[model samples]
Target: MTRYKMEEVLPLLEERVRRYTHNESTSVTYEKARQLMESLLYCLEEGENGNGMDIMAGEGDVKTAFTLGLARKKEKIKLAEELFEKIRKDFHSYHNHGYEETVMKGMPAFFLRYDIEFDGKNHLLTLDYPLFLEIEELTGIDLIYAYLKAARIEQDFLKHFPTLSVEEILRGFNGKYEEAYFNISEIVLYKALGCIMVKRPAGGLFMTEEDIMMLSKQLQERSKEELESKLQDALLSLDKELHLQSEVSEYFMTGLPKIVSNFLYYKKIKKVFLLFPKRKQKMKLQQKFQDGRVMEDEALRILIEKMQACESLEDRLYMVKENVRSLRDLKEILKECFWGDEFIQVFSLLSQEEVMVLKKEMKGRIAFGKGCIYKYLIKI
Candidate 1:
């Protein structure tokens, strides 16, 4: 941009405009021409940034600069294509629609129809799908190349595990995750860290609110550097257990801070209370934790019925916090709760005597679908 004056490039730009319009037009809107100029400079910037070259450092004009840039762009595209081949060889979509669309649809379009010559600045695709750590500062081919590089690393990391384990975790992470964009690697890493934080097996079991609380406490106790170090340790442990390649293990550090930040945000939102989330579905089941106490408050009774329809712990907790008023409400909710720990959250809400009273009151036989809860409660 600094090397050539608009006046100096005007005739060259007019020639390009004429060529693009098939010699039928010699003029365009100033903004369009400016964008075309950026297209020209985009190539030069690509050359300089990507290949460590200074195309405009000397007496090079826009054409020469653009020539060098186009060469770099083509090289990047070729490398991206190769990376795409690597990705396609053993990639699992995890049943995620966004990942499928971005890889199967968006990437192919970019490779097939990108106008590297006349429209290098044109960012043709809406990369609605995001990586664990997204590329935000770059656009067009720069974004594509960077994204491919990150995705290659993610593919390398994720493919180390059994595809079934991955599928299970992704489904467990969000049953509705596929409807929109999500970071596949982030979700997997989240599951891994959640287990690590609680001394459970990494990459198994859905993390509950209690696990989130423990994760937040562990992270919040540390200095910024310590938090980074802790997550790095967790990621490295997973890497060692999974036998990830050395460089791949190293690359995981970039995602730790983002995860830590996300966990801390949950604390700012005050994540108190628990709702035992055993599984997804509806079935005829007896209710315990009630001990023959009828819910006489009609509005409260209606709200409890509404609670039965909520599927996730987060949703149930929000509903309970916003609607349920007292310990009686919690006890009533517990009659429908399927399991406990959320590891010690339900108990944290009660005193020693109240807990003893509730423990004695919940002594009835288990509901048909509430075995996990019965097993968990008797242990208390």
Candidate 2:
């Protein structure tokens, strides 16, 4: 959560990387590296200050930081690939294993590791951690840790406003807000008992006045133990299954641009309650939706409905891969089973699996049109 100048952070990063090289127990975090990169990019591109005409840094400053962060990411990947190659060449024990191999073998103490496997014929590796070793060696930040840090950092931005009239702001001064119909995406991260709940501005649960009052009443009525238990059950669902995608599968499965938007537009909601900003520069928006709770509430309602309409796309992929008989059968099962948005994601992911499976199934032939469904499914 500490802020460091680039000069300080660079040496720190180098020292961290050096320490990681010597330390065997260290772990690499994909999200932390990403968050670090993002912070760099944000500083660089956004000029390291508020968007005020005088406060903003020069364009040169923006480009330098932005490009530096990108270059570092590229370099990290190159280093990771080199390290991976070295392991492949020198290590004899690590072979044809998936992500679970490290746990199973108890050897190959790599700073970063990948699961290499061949689905019968073609060799493949899980694309889980391409820069795992590099990030671990250079930075020991994990996604959750990064998120917590980010949440803290983001709350500072809210200092710009202690309170504002939601309706008056929506109307805007002299109708200027009408012209500035900008939307801002925000995230509120808070602990519910032992768990963390992530609520985005437009696409996650929101607390209504009634809901808030009800919660307060419940807190007053129930014993601390009872309240804590209920709150834990309700909010800790995000942490279930010991994986990031378990609780917020929809968030991750969202397209890259959307994911980037969420991260870039991230903000920590606090005591300051402001419905909409009359000025555009105050917020980073996910989409150019209307400027008010109406837009947020609608987005939340839609997201909830979408989330409820279908099973997790990851689960569905495995289900279809294991259960479906043919492309036609898969098509039929998914047609009636998935939401429109979920269907698109499921099809894209499943298509990759289908190609891998099809290669093994028919020796690369179009036997019985088993893989033909992929062509048709993608158009959806």
Best by lDDT: 1
Write the residue-wise lDDT of candidate 2 on 320-375 in tens digits.
44444444343445444554334433443333445454335434345323534334
Indicate the residue-level lDDT of 238 in model 2.
39
lDDT of each: 0.63, 0.33
Give the CA lDDT, 0 to 100, for residue 329 in model 2. Answer: 45
lDDT of 1: 0.63
TM-score for candidate 2, please give it.
0.20
Which ranges of candidate 2 are over 4 A from the true structure?
A: 1-204, 221-224, 236-244, 247-380
Error of 2 at 201 (Å): 14
After aligning candidate 1 to the native by TM-score, how far in Å is the CA of 227 from where it should be?
A: 3.8
Root mean square deviation (Cα) for candidate 1: 11.7
User: Which run of 10 residues does model 2 get worst, by summed lDDT?
Assistant: 114-123
User: Residues 1-380, candidate 1, lDDT per residue (tens digit)?
Assistant: 43567776666677667767788876788887887777767775655554445544555666666577779888878888898888878766777888888887888888899887778777688877788777887877878888878888888877754454565456545667667577877767766665665676553334555665666565556665676677677787787666777767766776667766765554455431111111221111112332434446887778777877775554565565355445566666766752454412344333445556656765674541254544444433
The estimated TM-scores of all candidates read 0.65, 0.20
Model 2's number of clashes is: 0
